[model samples]
Target: MSKNGSHFKVLFRPKAETFRGGCGECQTSCQSACKTSCTVGNQSCER
Candidate 1:
């Protein structure tokens, strides 16, 4: 499979939400910034 496909699998598979949610404390601003960057199509937050 391609790199994109692998990413899709990991992103959409069950239990993925565990990794998606921010750490709440340390991730508050950082997650927001990452989400904003992603919304603009930057996609730098994929990792």
Candidate 2:
């Protein structure tokens, strides 16, 4: 996370394939919100 905590980044990919919904709302709901929002928002993710 940045010093100010306004923005952060993390590297992760869900092990289950049932949560590939369009929006990343599932990630945050599962307590797995990606810091960069790349998994769901940008749809460019790598585990």
Best by lDDT, which number?
1
Candidate 1: count of backbone clashes, pairs at least 3 residues apart or interchain: 0
| lDDT (Cα, tens digit) per residue for candidate 2, span 1-47 | 66778575656767665365345433343224455444555453332
Off by over 4 Å in 1: 1-27, 38-47
Instruction: Please report, in order, the local distance difference test score of every candidate based on alpha carbons.
Output: 0.49, 0.48
Point to the candidate with the largest TM-score.
1
lDDT (tens digit, per residue) of candidate 1 on 5-44: 6533433554686557544454234456765675533333
lDDT of 1 at 47: 35
lDDT of 1 at 36: 62
C-alpha TM-score for every candidate: 0.19, 0.16
